[model samples]
Target chain A: MPFTMTAAALKIDHLGKRFGATAAVDDLSLEIAPGEIFGLLGPNGAGKSTTINMITGVTRPQTGSVSVFGYDNRRQALIARRLVGVMHQEIVIDHFFTVRQAIRIHVGYYGLPDDPGWRATLIERLGLGPHLAKPLRELSGGMKRRFMIAKAMIHKPRLLILDEPTAGVDIELRRSLWEFVREINGQGTTVLLTTHYLEEAEKMCGRIAIMNRGRLVALEGKETLLNRLGGRRLIVTLAQPLATLPAALAEDRSLLSWDPDHLTFAVAGPGAVGERLRRLALGGLHIADLDMRKPDLEEVFLQLTGNGNHHPAAEP
Target chain B: MTGPLPLPPFQPWLPFLTLLKREVLRFLRVSFQTLLAPVITASLYLFVFGATLGQRISVLEGFSYAQFVIPGLILMGIINNSFANTSTSLFMSRYLGNIVDLLVAPITAPQLILAYTLAAMLRGMLVGAVITLIALGFAPLPWVYPGLGLVMALLSSFLFAQFGLIAAIHANTFDALSMFTNFLLLPLIYFGGVFYPVSILPPFWEGLSRCNPLFYLIDGFRFALLGSGDNPFWLSFGISAAMAGGLFLWAALLIATGYRLRN
Candidate 1:
């Protein structure tokens, strides 16, 4: 995809934060195009939360600025905040509030008029109607998370930031949350997501930014990032087991591993599969089955993050 | 693929009102701890003092001991409950990490201060009204200048609410919060002439009591109801108005600076 410097939904310019002598986010700059699911991936303590804090105005940045929908977050915080909604990493609902009351109060804060229809739709969609009258303390963990989403969506903000939204939830709930997020994004809301689940990010995010030690390590389209790693593994099943590797395959033995009738070769690129298969054919190897696997976000993430150095088997 | 979102009409008052409603409901939902408990404690104070000391001493002219103590008790409830309403609510929100709702909202620092102070004042007023009604059983409940009485009650509540927000912002632990109430607030209440008039104290102690803002609040409130107090009505009123305005501005500045509440 061609990169253009059009208007952005969210923009961060040379943002930096520090606690005493240690820098949390150092000179970070990025712009998220409107209506895209942008993924922010980082290891623990890599300044993802600090950047979110600066964007949300929970913590003022020592350097640079954040603008949401053309409004400088610090100078025009009220206007900037109105355009943004955030589902916090923790379930931070007030224990004394009923589900309905909590959503109403949140809506009121954005100066949005009370809309019963929209409220009902949100409750029904999040499956929180039955818990409307129950205090937050009475709800289950997943229910509280759903209620948090309901609160965040009360004003139908143009930008939604989800920080680890599905962490610790069951698979079913996680999928449901993803669907709800996608549904809202489909309605023209820009989404910024941070998650530990690379599979989720790979499946959902259009573009991904990886951070390490308060710096941007990689940022690109998901496919571009994955392809840039140039990692592919080919597994071939031979018709007969071989005690010794054939001469043609022996030269490629470093890339090839054998287990019974199956041989796995670590190919450098997707195009190498054709060349390797042609080589095997010439070597008089009877191939019963063949499978080619392109690198996924996990492999790329591990590589860019240098996790591959310490733990080579970081990705399954 | 997406068009611009229609911006909502900026009804600024709605956010303030909603925040006030949330703060009020927070305490009303836990009436046992926020309301009934304070009223019960006030009643116990009234019973212990009015029953034992009422029969022996008459502190002021043309008034029984119970009548003289009633206004002080009502004001005490106002100060304590008002401060507790804001301090406890804000501290609890911070402790539980739920204050992000308010911090991230489209409300300014002054607006936030107003919402918290007003809600706290409302709780304080409600508690004060209940205690006054309960005190009627002990005394006739004088009402000389009803308008002035209302003004005094509001100013006192507003002042204490601001103080409470300041305390909540500075306090990091439960023990720290209690220190504000026990060491600072309770001493001010006791020394402010809740049980005895400052006029009866020695010259040095009376001058020292004048320094306590709560003394002015109680003295003014008593003068409004009974037409008599240690200081002139204007002095008390001036002191309260100054404290309320000054403390409110200070708290608003602190809030705007994101002191303690935000990183």
Candidate 2:
């Protein structure tokens, strides 16, 4: 059982779905490890939701299969669903039900008796205790999102899929939500998240799969993705305004650009930044201050999924 | 870190019970619309049809117009409320995007159909009972065979609830949902011996009335209530029972196929 849990919290093999002439998801395959926070990043119409839908059995796959905790989604849907919990992108809860009542209904869905202690802990953690008696319609967007998270966690599912969990949340609330997610992950729930907020994925996910046009463009650790850009930027603040570029600096025009007050250079390696600084100094260019900018996941995302000739995982 | 928590033994019926409770509560929460309003509507029909028309007409040989219309109105209440309960709930769930609550659960399609259908039946029966009480105020409703009356009522509720479920699945908008209730259901109810006996109709019209399933349900209900109907009690009972079973299977099939409920 332990081995089964570790092998794949979720496994999608050659999954495909089509609506009319359009393919919503095409030959999508992924495996999420137990106890890992996996980020599924994509732009609009990128099939992240489609894949999530198939995993939760909300939508059937036209081809292939999804297995959750060793239960095939189609053949053993009930068991597969038992192992997974999903917080949908929409705030789709019953408006007539109060927060507590809604959560109770969700708890009952998993066949669990209401545990007041656990319910209280979750409510307090989500900062929803004050509004437990408020109807869902009365709650704010962020509060509703918190309620959704709380509902998803009620079942103690082995796999929790959060689709755009922080979409409409404020910055402070997003922080709190992230902390809450980490807390749950710490308690052994494997989180599969999708978000438009790249920074959220960078900070929270151990691994991420970037999809575009119903295909995965990149799947790797956050650090590995960032490192693929292969270099960093050097921003140099000049001591005095430069009317014109020095001949020595002008020689390497491909790597450097300068305005009246600052010079920017794309350095190839860690040692190259220092080498360029020495070169600029030797050329009698004065530097007031210098800062190195590390490449981030956002850059890699734009490059791989952006309008470019480089197609990291383009379909044949 | 400690290992993952072990989940308790999942009792499958718990979800069915929860969904059933939620569906029932959905209507009860708005009792004014789901229960009281229907009773009020049925009362107005009783007033307009029985009070106004009773003095001028007598459709049955032994019964007064009020007695004849009472069973028909009660059965009409059952059919309307049952269909309304399931159709509106399912459609609203889809419209508001809340259907995912059921879709994501570890419940089967059969359980889903049963829960929604049972809840619809309850709402229908509640309204029917209220309307029957109102009808009783006007005239005594004899239960010639209480068992058959109860069975007929249950079967009629079941069949129409399944109809509502099908309509909800097929309807993409509120307009489409109302179209079924208005265009199809209202027409059938009106022509199904709700207002008059099928035996009195022209030969061509009588045969056409037989095609309407509501005719059998209303006739079966009338036979149970007054021991008088245009068709044999056995025929009416058999038709309603067969329809109930067939509609139930169709509902189960649509749910299992994921129909419009899923992608």
Candidate 3:
């Protein structure tokens, strides 16, 4: 986060876009550090894809600017574009080409040469080697996703933006895909990702930005946000079923759940749990087993978005 | 694949060249529909109108009707295929959502237009060449003003290819695209003096035919191939060149600005 004199790898400055009176991305500004894995999380219609589209020059920003490395995405568009590679949300497979031919041809789209060694490395790395001579459209869904990854990395881009890379994929592909993403980040390629799976973001991202209805709701380091927004929960199981006479404990607003068997409260610090326990004993409540639960990314995401039946991307 | 390779030298035109190659390969992959279909259609016209009908009527001086219609058939093939290639290529890319490949490319607008147009022209000319060979079997035709013939072919192909680019940009559905070919394009080709001499028509129809744009292309090509046409070579060539130049500017503007191609 200390991107002082060194330029940010991807800098979005008050970027805004509107579609027919709807603000798809409203006055959003965020910076990504070089060699960092950044996560953008939101619910459906939260403008994640619009933001990526602006960054990749697929859509122009209405109010603000985007820059990749040191080049403005609009003014120095060709240069800025060369530095960023994108794997679109959709598969977008071309039926006219073989997998090898499409990957080799796509390299030139970024004005890069066809380095056979680098090309082979990418094909093998993405597990696309055996399907090289097959038509691109003939590949199965998982294989097509792998082919897309190879295409996105064919130019050896400095920054890679993946819009929902693991959506609808099986568990094995998702695990290998995340591992490959981490491997690429380790090799100095800055990555910006938006995914539906919150647990994946928790494990992969160093910094996370949460958006809601086209605005930034939270931006912090992974652990900091987890602690600040996803505070710990303390659950206490009662020795006996209580019949509705816990006014003193119920009045505390941090208390989340109470049942015949248990009482739960949201606790910010370790001290809060012990203090609550002493108060419970003083109130003549029988002693019971106590359990502590650490909040995961899913809790924070649910609280921020208020709904999660779908995902957050391609709203614009 | 064990060790990373050093980056290769950058070629500025690599993207343009690759796109051009892709566009050409697209039609060639379906050679039956693109090349053989047009050739077969042209030969049918030759056989029906010229071989069977030629024994009765002669349209031009010292040249049989078969020889006269040959040039027109070739020009029509060049025009239709040129338009078909680019329009289908661009529209299919949009329909399948793969146009994002071109949208994200580092190449410029002119490079994009030239690549598509040139590839379309190659297909158009290939179809024209096959039709020409088929025409040769029907009649002994003189290759009059061969250099002029090539120039006229290039200009006609360039004009139609650009028009196809514009059509693709504006077409929202396959129905809209088919309307262009059925209602507008075929009628113009039919009225443009493809099957018969414009001179044989009534004065009013002949005068109206002069106003049709395809008339100039066919007339100019006829002058080049058979040394006889309704209009002189310079007049037809000049009009075709001017139209191509104007269309180029329009196509270049639309492509550079991503008019209907991007949001």
Candidate 3 colliding pairs = none
How far off is model 2, as Cα RMSD? 3.8
Residues A83-133, model 2: lDDT tens digits? 888999978879778898899999888887777888888888889989988
lDDT of 3 at A1: 22
**TM-score winner:** 2
lDDT of 1 by residue, B1-263 (tens): 33333455778888888998899899999999999998999898888767777656789888888888988988888888999999999999999999899889998887888889888898889889999888888778579987998899999899999999999999999999999999999999999988889889999999999888889889999999988888899999998999999998888888989899789
> What are the Cα lDDT values of the candidates?
0.86, 0.86, 0.84
Candidate numbers, best TM-score first, in rank order: 2, 3, 1
Query: What is the per-residue lDDT of model 1 for residues A1-316, given as tens digits with 9 covering 90 to 100?
Result: 1113335789999999999988899999998988799999999888998999889998889999998877889888888899899988888978898888889999999888898998898898788988888988899998988888888888888889989988887788788788988988887788999999999999999999999888899989999998764556678999988777778776663243576688777676345677778778887889899887876788778778877532232111
After superposing candidate 1, which stretches have Cα over 4 Å from the reference? A1-6, A235-265, A269-290, A310-316, B1-6
Docking level for model 1: acceptable
Q: Whose DockQ is higher: candidate 1's or candidate 2's? A: 2
Q: What value of lDDT does candidate 1 attain over all alpha carbons? A: 0.86
Q: For model 3, how does the per-residue alpha-carbon lDDT over A67-134 read when each residue is reduced to its tens digit? A: 77767888988777787889998899779889988997899777777889989888777788899999
Docking class of 3: acceptable
Query: What's the CA error at residue B162 for candidate 3, in Å?
Result: 0.5
lDDT for B33 in candidate 1 is 91
